[model samples]
Target: MAGCTGATSERTAAAVHGLPEDALLDMGDFAGAVLKYLRRHPVDRLTIAGGFAKLSKLAAGHLDLHSGRSQVDPRHLAALAREAGAGEDLAGAVAAAGTGLEALRLCAAGGVALGDRVAEAARATALGVLRGAPVTVDVLCVDRAGVVVGRAAPAGPPERGTAGGAARQD
Candidate 1:
């Protein structure tokens, strides 16, 4: 799993059953590491779950999940807040947030289920990334508290405007 926070390691292990071992990788090496592992192990199914913002980038086919390499676009957060029916002040606050956690907190304060929305977005992006791959792909969104806020399986039909498209709050 690609993630920006320390909690991703524990959360991913809990979510993916039968994971024999885990390896930590930097954002620059994440894609290469995954490819190497797949070549060696050849798993039938793969599940990727992590922090919402980092997972979003990974799902979008970007290997760099580092905060510096890939950032949560403030405009996207603002848009999501607006779609969640946030007031202008809340939207502005989200837009100004410097980190994903801050943005999430702002959303919570604004009465928006940001976690769920992030999970959906990450799932869509993961689907897009794994399109046509032999292995099944499942994506989960986990919050800082190690709570599962969103999940998606490969069996479902892809939703339009998802898959690295515009940010959708629904």
Candidate 2:
């Protein structure tokens, strides 16, 4: 997992519990390293989760999951609000939020299912990254309080469609 700091210790604990190889990806060449690792040792499944703010970028197919290297585009958040049927005022609020969590709060206040959209986006990004591999992906979105806000799983075979992907964050 990238950006494995603070609230993301669950991933580290889970990784430690498992009896297998673990590596800290180099931020400079994250995608290359991930692809190489996958090629060297194929896996049956992959699960990724992270903070809500950080996960937004990872959900966008960004291999470099470092917060410093990536960001949640407010435009995307606004689009999500609009897709969820949020009024223009709510969308504007989401777009103007100073932080992802703030945007999420705005969505909650406006009764928009932003978490689901974020989860789906994450799944799509993960699928895009592992486009050709026959791997099952699970994406989970969690909040700062360590609560699951959203989740997604591959529907079926690894077809080249936008249905399945993996990774999540809080």
Best by TM-score: 2
Instruction: Report the poorest 10 consecutive residues by lDDT, candidate 1.
Output: 161-170
Task: Estimate the lDDT of model 1.
Answer: 0.55
The lDDT for every candidate, in the order shown, is 0.55, 0.61
Model 2 C-alpha lDDT per residue in residues 1-170, reported as the tens digit of each score: 33132334344424533523253322232433454365456566555555666666665656666657777888788887788788999999998999999998899887887877776776666555555576555555677766766556543235634365443322
| Candidate 1 clash pair list | none
Sum up the clashes in candidate 1.
Answer: 0
So what's the TM-score on candidate 1? 0.63
Candidate 1 per-residue lDDT over residues 28-115, each given as its tens digit: 3264245335435544555555766665455444555666666677767677667767888888998899887788778887778766
Q: Which candidate number would show the highest lDDT if scored against the true structure?
A: 2
Clash totals in order: 0, 9
